[model samples]
Target: MSSLKPILLVEDNPRDLELTLAALEKCQLANDVIVARDGEEALSLLTHRDPGSGEFTLVPAVVLLDLKLPKVDGLEVLERMKGDPETRHVPIVMLTASREESDLVRSYQHGVNAFVVKPVNFRDFFQAIRDLGVFWAILNEPPVTTRRPPASTYAKGV
Candidate 1:
């Protein structure tokens, strides 16, 4: 059931990023991970044009977001994703260091599918990433979309 779709990691801290990537590497899911250094970059990579390419391509899969980010914050990214019709169905899991009650409440309210607080211990962090990878990549059922082919495919005479 592993779709091989890329996992989007939206994190700002270098240490956390390294740890999470390492944990993800240990997991059964060896799927390619796309990393965005900040919330703005994360949003662009996930929902908008690729900064280097400027193409409207669909990179299907879920987003693992961190709350505290530079530029556009995680909450803002979540809001934009949930607000848009095209991106709303994409599952967004919040993986952040913040344990504030308000952060949790706002995340869920903004339609985050899952919320995980960063574990202080290395073992716990690894376990959390592994579990997250297993569940989202294998267990979860994403929405299905049906669409007509592009105009180029249609007969010009008709």
Candidate 2:
């Protein structure tokens, strides 16, 4: 069987990204954390559209989405993910700097599995990421899909 797919991290801020990555690393969950600098890039990675190859199919274990992303923005990405049947079931946690009630309401409204407001303090940020990693990567049981049997099962005995 193929290895479990990586966890997608949709964040654009370099400093925040580094801190998040460090925190995840401390928890040892960073191994599968795939970083996307913006919402557009995040979408492309999730959709598996290789600009050169033209093939488009990717499904990750989870998506840690930042709300204030460039171009497409996080809410739009969340909307797209929830709207698409192929990608709808994947867990998405909204991570944002803003504590606006409107943003929180909209995030939950759009089907975000969790909403986390990133703290400006480094220690708090670290703790948040560690907790986030533990909850999503260790505690959560991701939705299951039926797997097909190997093609060899249909062949005659040697």
TM-score of each: 0.83, 0.84
Per-residue accuracy of model 2 over 1-158 as CA lDDT, tens digit each:
23555667889888888898888889976336778889998887767644554544456667889999999999999999999876888899999999999999999999999999999888999999999888887788878854322322221110
Model 1 lDDT tens row, 1-158: 23356678888899998888888778857456778888888776665544455533445467899999999999999999999887788889999989999999999999999999989898999899989987887788877754212222221110
Which regions in candidate 2 have their CA more than 4 angstroms from the true location? 49-57, 146-158
Worst ten-residue run, lDDT, model 2?
A: 149-158
Clashes of 1: 0
Could you tell me how far off, in angstroms, the CA of residue 69 lies in candidate 2 after the best superposition?
Answer: 0.9
Candidate 1's TM-score reads 0.83
Pairs that clash in candidate 1: none
Residue 38, model 2: lDDT of 90
